[model samples]
Target: MKKIIFSVLFLGVIIVLLMQTELGQMLRSGNIQEVAANIQSYGWVAFFIAIAAVVIQTFFPVIPFVLLAGANVLAFGLWVGFGVSWFAAVMAALANFALARYAARDWAEKKMGHHSFVKNLNRHAETKGFIIILLARWIPVLPSSAINTAAGISKIPFKWFLLATLLGKIPAVFFESVLGHYMINWEAHKGKLVLIGIGLVVFMLGINYVKKKKKSTLLS
Candidate 1:
């Protein structure tokens, strides 16, 4: 049927998009000295590269924003990292949002016909988008990049989406930025910093759980 055909095409596109790049390999290296040298020479240029990666990386299996966000903290410091990560995250979300609103929705509606499980999910995300974004960012399983696309496509309000993206992403981005700071000065306060990140993550999770329960109850 139409659904089967659409599914096949979707799978094919996913396979094509995940093809690896040379740069992706270089950055994944754990050699801190090598990474430091590259940053020392190319720090300014790397900022733009990070932006480009956020825009294009929706295709790849890799989570480019998370990688770059961590890198910003290590190379630039916490405030710089937080700013870069937040900006890139917001820009990428906006791009994905436009694509979903303009392109994917019609195709999805046609293929799924009606009665989709996401019909309700989309409604929730659209109405309480800020909370939804916060929850998605907190939930480790869902890629923040993916959420950007989904939120856009779901026709969530632009203002809500932007607000959610900024506030919601704070927990993870802050944690990683702080984590990088610790790694840089790790011998000083190692255990304490680690505990702090863990606590923040757990607190965010509790917030997400309560929000979900309340939303579900109201929707029901």
Candidate 2:
């Protein structure tokens, strides 16, 4: 607990310092295009940094993954950016899983014991582990870190977890990459961007509605 708290505080201090830098200022501005352009100026090093950022954010949960995905697309184009983002997400998930299972074992166990949702996930993991993980990954609003932690503490096989993560991340990463690409190039593809945005909104709404219905049914 002391180590985790210290690490978080240390990270917070680093973030505060970074926010004072020009690059961090750009990030804080939330201009994805400008941030991507700046990061791209560093060439190949930026790719490694981007991946590291994804992994770090998995533990920290400070940076918005969506913005990072968009920045990758702007920096590396559609295909390469999609590949990088997808791979990074996978790596991050695996890292978090390992952390929960090993480094944060006590924390993971405590979280599982305290959270009813996590307990439910653990129960489902005993049987339909892959499906439970797949749905959590497929649904953007679901807390990915918590799910990863819960899965790590459960009896689910690592192979199933890996397979489900790989399969589930494809569409989400693709959506982020395409949407980001089009959004950055909006002047040339305004109509397509609008359609994509509308489609995404509808999809999210439908998912939320289904979740609400499921919750209500369970309560009843």
Candidate 3:
């Protein structure tokens, strides 16, 4: 309880600071391109700041991460952008998992018991936790924070969590970086980008469908 309170207070302070600062103002402007341009202006320091921003956003979650991923791609291009975004996202996810497991364990457990989606995750954690984590990462609709928190609260091993997170994030982050890259250069690769986007969507949906069917079969 004390830990949770302290964490909340700390987060509150950070939020207040951000809202009063230039960073907060830029975020409030809702201009991804502008933010990207500003980050790019910082030169090499931009990569470090971008990584820190990703980690911070995971905790605060006020900013849409897709915007950050896009900004990284805009500043660093395809390969480097993907690498940075993927690494930062993995780090952020691990941080969230650790925070939930340590600082917020009791609260997270109680909350998971109350929420249906999280409840289901708790069940899967007892069995195929890795697959659950992997699938959750791929499905954009499934909240990543919830999965991280729930995994921490459940009996899933840290190794499985880490492995699943490392693998699961690949496709999603790659897709985000690639899409952003193409979007910026849309005039040249508009058709190819659209096809890639469709293919990714279809692939994710197919994997999700298969997983659901497998689950249903086991239950039956």
| Cα-based lDDT for every prediction | 0.60, 0.77, 0.79
Q: Tell me, by lDDT, which candidate is best.
A: 3
Give stretches of model 2 more than 4 Å off. 1-29, 183-194, 208-220
In candidate 2, what residue range of length 10 has the lowest lDDT sum? 13-22
Tens-digit lDDT track for model 2 on 122-150?
77776798888888887766777877888
Clashes counted in candidate 3 amount to 0
Model 3 stretches with alpha carbons more than 4 Å out:
115-117, 124-127, 184-189, 204-212, 215-220
Worst 10 residues of 1 by lDDT: 111-120
Assess every candidate by TM-score. 0.64, 0.76, 0.81
Backbone clash numbers for all candidates listed: 2, 0, 0
Judged by TM-score, which candidate is best? 3
* Candidates, ranked, lDDT: 3, 2, 1
**Cα error of candidate 3 at position 104, Å:** 2.2
Give the clash count for model 2: 0
Tell how far residue 5 is off in model 1, in angstroms.
19
Question: What residue runs in model 1 are displaced by over 4 Å at the alpha carbon?
Answer: 1-22, 28-36, 56-67, 105-118, 180-190, 193-201, 204-220
TM-score of 3: 0.81
lDDT of 1 by residue, 105-155 (tens): 565455432433235447776567667666677666576655765665564
